[model samples]
Target: MHRHFQGLALLAVAAALAILAPVFCAERPAAAGAAPSPDSQSAAPVVIQVDAAHPTGPYSPAWNYFGADEPNYVYSKNGEKLLRELAALSPAPVHVRLHNLLTTGDGAASLKWGSTNAYREDADGNPVYDWTITDRIFDAMLDAGVQPLVEVGFMPEALSTHPEPYRHDFPKGDIFTGWSYPPKDYAKWAALVTAWATHLRDRYGVESLNGWLWEVWNEPDINYWHGTPEEYDRLYDVTAQAIRSVLPNALIGGPDSTGPGTGRAAEFLEQFLEHCLRGKNSATGGTGAPLNFISFHPKGSPTEVDGHVRMGIQRQLAAMDRGMKIVASFPEYKHTPIILGESDPEGCGACSVATNPSDVYRNGPLYGVSVAEAEARTYELARKNGVVLKGSVTWALEFEDQPYFAGFRDLATNGVDKPVLNVFRMLGMLTGEWLPTTSSGGLPLDDILNSGVTRAPDVNAIATRSEHEVDVFVWNYHDDDVQVPPANVHLNVDGLRQGRVRVEQFRMDSDHSNSYRAWLDMGSPAAPTPEQQAQLERAGKLETLGTPQNLKIAGGRLPLTFDLPRQGVELVRISWR
Candidate 1:
């Protein structure tokens, strides 16, 4: 439960690092808040090619997973608007994970906490389960074309074994308070779960609710859970058994531990898996519990280094690597879908830049760039470890009525989408079969995962070719917060019909699709007028770099060119006839 100590840095040193070619030649600083370019340029650029004809793997949509700490916020004005935006981003249903669904409260939400008032008791202390608030939360998701990852957690006041201090007040800086305690009665806890599952099935229909994911709790390997390991194990067993009693086809899995790269947390996950596979069920007296999937939390540790915020992408990747390795060790779960319960740039999405300078990245384009890198690496990791990655939840969403650019790790501020959200929109545009891609300027996956883009910056791209179109996403990412020169990329298309091609480019940069920069440019107005708000909303959307163009390729091979600024992402789509 300790949060102070830094995890052990596990880097893959044996992986080779490829020196990317300086294709764009000139080292010019990137415009729109990107890194400043070098003084001059060099030659002998590496030529990265995309072979669209050869398919590699399935283009699983991992970008659709999003979440937040406050479950009640899903029904808020901004929360509803943001959910619609997320829903429109992808064709698939957006899966959102939230905490404090069953905690006792008046349906209030805040940074690092939330409550639904799903359980309570009378003066005589009779069990009372209320699904009113919980139903509204799920209703909002379903109405917005989204579904809940369905995190059932945080012991309610009436059910908590240690209910002396039930409610956690984060405004008063109370964390992991009495709500983190275990339940007083196991049968009652299981009954609560059964009622929850039955209510969901009856309300949403069994077929619809069956597709939803149910996780036991938040990060139990950390301070979020106060119970002993065995106690938590028994809790999980009862929770699972109870949920299944109502909806037998329900998909559920958990133990959502902290970063597995951390020594103690890694050991905790291993032991938990061993408990599920080998250890006997504390409640049912069986060999194991029903584990349909596996889940864990991994967070990046960003800090101000050398007067700049350098993101710990390596730390997050190491945790994923270790987590997959641990799961792979168990032959039973090797094929289980692994869900990254919560993935983000750092911990405490509510912590503001006023409190921590390192979080300043949230209000800018770096957040978007980091997301692009994270998406590519996650798929790469799953392939390397031979695992099925069902989803990876981005645990920060909108904080309603928050000041503009407050520096909270959210996709939007006060209803205006951030640059990072645009990245997800770009990812949503890419679907269908996966095309093999190579980038001369892109760093090796191992290098980016282990050391980040600190060495020379990674100008990378991934291509997806569908039946009639090819989409290539490119980015210029660097760990350090400094803005560097934009890298001009020359994308070579290897296999395409020699005919008319229509190309479009969507970009996320300081000036193009970033509302934060627009807000700053407007003198950081605390209260923007109607016109200004309209302008900000427009800027927050996915913007195109230039007018759409048509190309006539003589042969089946074509060459495309574009400039990607540091901490910027560009999606180039080409449709051919």
Candidate 2:
């Protein structure tokens, strides 16, 4: 069958599975209920079945995208190291999105703040352009072999209508400063963008620069953009036009609004799409502006409940659902690629546990499993909605000079990788076409959408098939942070041509591939010695379960069983030998 047709069929099967009478309908296995404790073993096994004969559509590496609000960190010592790590995770070039590229400042960085001073006026009120800081930022990305999802935003201080208070102190005070406002002159704004694009094209040939992604601004439905909807749309038009003028084939899109689960955000997204399809172009007098892709942010709501953190996975998924539904409603742009500009456990990446205790999940396997589950379900949601999801940016990066395991929503703290980063590494291992898989312990999509995983742990698996191997990515996740028993997973794979296969498994839990737990075991050091730091770095990387196992296949089926702890993620690779 054609790959596209096969993917549609697979989606139809998934839709049917969502409405099954009994949610856990994969094979005959005992019920895998809530565990007794974090250390206890599971009594019942959750059976997961993977059919490798059928090939779905080609897999898209959506999890490779990452971003941060602090643009200056791109060149910091730790930031550059983290960028290299991110680039090496996958064969595909990672795309990074950043904020405050045009904001005026001295090229300093802090929590939720960064600047390039790319634009400033001369003594006689003429436009002055400086690409030094911006070049350093892009140069770092290129040096690391990553693409830039350039966010053309945060009005320059010289052009902002309200430029007195250009920067803000975040996590302590308001962040909607003067730079968030619209430009005082649209023509000047366009000129600034044009100059920036021209410089990028000149420095790095047009062919190299054309591969970069571009977007107007971030979260216009919220404080990130201080303007009316029409005004923001106009700004997008001008910015898009300016970039294309330098490189006509640039990939650009906009409105990067907040989550659409709320009414106002949904309306904003819908109006923006409608305007893109029909509204007059403010830059060209054309019928509509150029929209190469759609962008939005979907964040969860995690709160400290009863002294433990309870994640709001449903909230984040709902936003994705609503946003895709809106896009699918418009035939003119339904097939356009959609990028989740900032998909995370919650907003406020810079907020630490000292202020927001619920963010403690950032340090352990909870964040890892949460991300695995979210990315897995997103593939299902995209199939159901018949829309293409290009990428989902994990709005996190390294925070320089921070405490070890400080509860900030970041991929790394003080140059040490977190457990969540290993999850991305595991995801990066998955390639080729998707294979149909179902888990007995997984709740239906509607059930998860309605009540989350609070009732029972969500033990699920998504599998893929390549020419040489088949990979199954499994996760045991729960919304509540309470300790639970490990789940016994019986993964059955069919349609392998060989009589035997070599199995390799990678895990991220409290005991493996987790730097936070390692640090805690070391008495939670304030500053680790160089030797300890090396040990922590080793522990932070993805670790396998001992050596690879050679398992025999019976009746064209491979049965592999393992114990997966709650808030844990595992990637099982079966290689043909």
Which candidate's lDDT is highest?
2
- Candidate 2 backbone collisions, by pair: none
Show model 2 residue runs off by greater than 4 Å.
1-43
lDDT tens digits, residue span 425-543, model 2: 99998888888888878777877777776767788888888888999999998887776678999989888875778999999988899988888778778989999999899989999
What's the C-alpha lDDT at position 239 in model 2?
Answer: 94
Q: lDDT values of the candidates?
A: 0.78, 0.83
TM-score per model over all chains: 0.92, 0.93
Residue-level lDDT tens digits of model 1 in 1-577: 1142133232222210000101112122222244334521123243557787787766878768888778888899988999999999978778998888888888877666778888888898788988889989999999998888888898998888777676656545557787888999888888888888888888989879867888898888776788888888888888988888887878889888987987989988998998898889977898988888888877777655545667788888888888988999899997899998877767777766555544656888888888888777887788888888888889888887667888788999887889999999999988887887776666666665656666667677787888889988888787776644567678898788888899899999877888988887787799999999999999899999779889887678878776667788899889966
Name the regions of candidate 1 deviating beyond 4 angstroms.
Answer: 1-46
